[model samples]
Target: MSFLDKMFASIGIGAAKVDTILANDRLVAGDEVNGRIVIQGGKIDQDVDDIYLKVMTSYEQEIDDKKVHKECVVGKFRLTERFTIKAKEKREVPFSFELPIDTPISYGKTRVWVETGLDIKNAIDPSDRDYIEVHPSPLMSKVFNAVTDLGFRLREVECEAAPFHARRRLPFVQEFEFVPTKGEFRGRLDELEIIFLETNRNYLELLIQVDRKARSIGGLLSEMLNLDETNLRLTITNDNAHNIKDMLYQVIKKYS
Candidate 1:
């Protein structure tokens, strides 16, 4: 049987049902997550003292040199309602709350899951989990686009398991990886990794790793570049692009 069915059976309530209806399935940071909770009573009448909603996200962890998995609670809300439902009765309760901006994006889309449940003492709780997608603002898109235009292909995007201690408000961090394009460092590097930290300031931290290609006589040489600044924009003009080619030729001339 389904999880809901099993929960209701444990409560001796025959078959309780719960459903959630969201006003808007798509939302963004600083937007309200409005929805209604629907609960259907089972074979007999029951009193629900309260209702609660829990937002959760599943993320990866590292332990013993191996990857571990865990789910974290992002937020919780309690409804101030005590109602009685008769047998074969259905009830709908409305709820509206603001979503935290730091909510992790899942499935390449900015969507998070929320689970709603009823608090009936000594009874199996009826719960429902809903997924809502959030869209980032134009500023966020600008930063992302700039990186992509720089020939930095996305490697992987994930939320860091640790909470951003610097900023107590944010609970997770998003990391993006990119592979450098063939340029002056064509055969001299492997990839670059970027991590976006949470802070009141609207600046992004960039970490670049230069992996050197193996040579016949020498050992591998790797370098890292860390950039922390604001209003950062990287552009490749025709003149500069050509100049880069000249610079590459000069470098080869000196090395070879």
Candidate 2:
């Protein structure tokens, strides 16, 4: 290539570009995502220090008392070590990694994606992105399904900024909100907001805040300010997964 061509390539113009190709974009948390990075060489050979991928998601973060969307890297992995890409050559590298058990599910207003970039010496790096649909783990789905079995309607689900009280691997947490339309909680509880702390092989942890409906003038004022709620801690095992409703009912009853 001509000197001019090399100079432009050094500045990232017409440089090697990368794209991630996943076997299947839709997957549940705790499952392995298999993909290959296809790198198409540009005008000149380039020495790459490394190629890496990051699992990213957007979260709500409060800044200056206002909420803003912030992109966060939930997990990362290096695809390869030092390598050289010959001019006009194309290369592919395969990779597989488990999505974190706590990875946020792709639901209303929530998104997940994989981003890839090359670490090159003395040259601008090239990057690519592939969005994915992440679903809940089997254990998490069972818990949510139990809520429905108990007649609680799934009202809303969203990725929210993690408050100080929430301890999580990511900066944000997803909350599933539900309202009991029929059952013991119908009149006593207004809604319940739950954050799945995590789901391990042995147990699942949940942080729940149950909101109560207003009874009188004083109660109404507290509800408006979001002050009338009961917080509960719950842990369920594989054994209890089958009877999650009963466990939830007992906990709600104690607060009710």
Candidate 3:
């Protein structure tokens, strides 16, 4: 017998097997995941002590000039079901659990994946990994579309490691980079970095970093603005080459 077979035999599992089945094939953050554990016994009866379920995620982190592996336990459960399995007998146990809302999107189309596993004592552990596509909230999509409609095209999107204090409920921040397509500030500015906070009460917080190009005389100027201000005003100009034409007009008009 192989070493694994010997180990299984020592655990009193002559030929035990474990399988997991989910009620739905797809899941989203904040959704309940329901499934069943199927256990098939071998030639000898075995006493099961405990069962455990764990949810894990694999992500990359930069450490000391190199990328390293980081695995986190998002969730875990200690099952209370205990029983004795007769020779050649089968048993099934049902389980239901909730997925956390703050789960990070790790795949395309804002999707996140979760790996679920069953730890069967004295036997080999069985696990399953699946993808969950996260649909952007209506408010989120609205704000995104609004920015695009304002002549800003998306240049890049990424998740930041640091948590921002402007809004709550986010352990990781998502940044969207855009280039101006029209208006007075077009070529004058490099790109805009935008961060969206949590959606609440039909409103969302937009954090913007405006990068200004260097002037011919050799000095560069950049500014950060908070979009939540009510009294803030800017003139809307139709200059196609200047992306921040409207902003510049407003500033110039205010000073004049």
CA deviation > 4 Å runs, candidate 2:
none
Best by TM-score: 2
- lDDT over C-alpha atoms for residue 144 of model 3: 53
Order the candidate numbers by TM-score, best to worst. 2, 1, 3
Model 3 is weakest, by summed lDDT over 10 consecutive residues, at 228-237
In model 1, which regions exceed 4 Å deviation?
1-9, 12-15, 107-111, 163-171, 182-189, 199-256
Q: What does candidate 1's lDDT look like per residue over 148-170, in tens digits? A: 55454566776555544533444
Comparing 1 with 3 on TM-score, the higher-scoring candidate is 1
Could you tell me how far off, in angstroms, the CA of residue 46 lies in candidate 1 after the best superposition?
A: 1.7
Q: Name model 3 segments beyond 4 Å from true.
A: 1-6, 9-19, 25-28, 37-58, 77-90, 106-111, 122-124, 163-171, 181-189, 196-208, 213-256
Model 1, C-alpha of 135: deviation from truth (Å): 2.8
Q: Provide the global lDDT of candidate 1 against the true structure.
A: 0.58
- TM-score, per-candidate, Cα-based: 0.70, 0.92, 0.60
**Cα RMSD to native, each candidate?**
8.0, 1.8, 8.3
lDDT of candidates 1 onward, in order: 0.58, 0.86, 0.55
lDDT tens digits, residue span 46-148, model 2: 8899999998989887799999988999899987889999888999999999987778888878889999999988888898989999987667788888888
**Model 1 worst lDDT window (10 residues):** 224-233
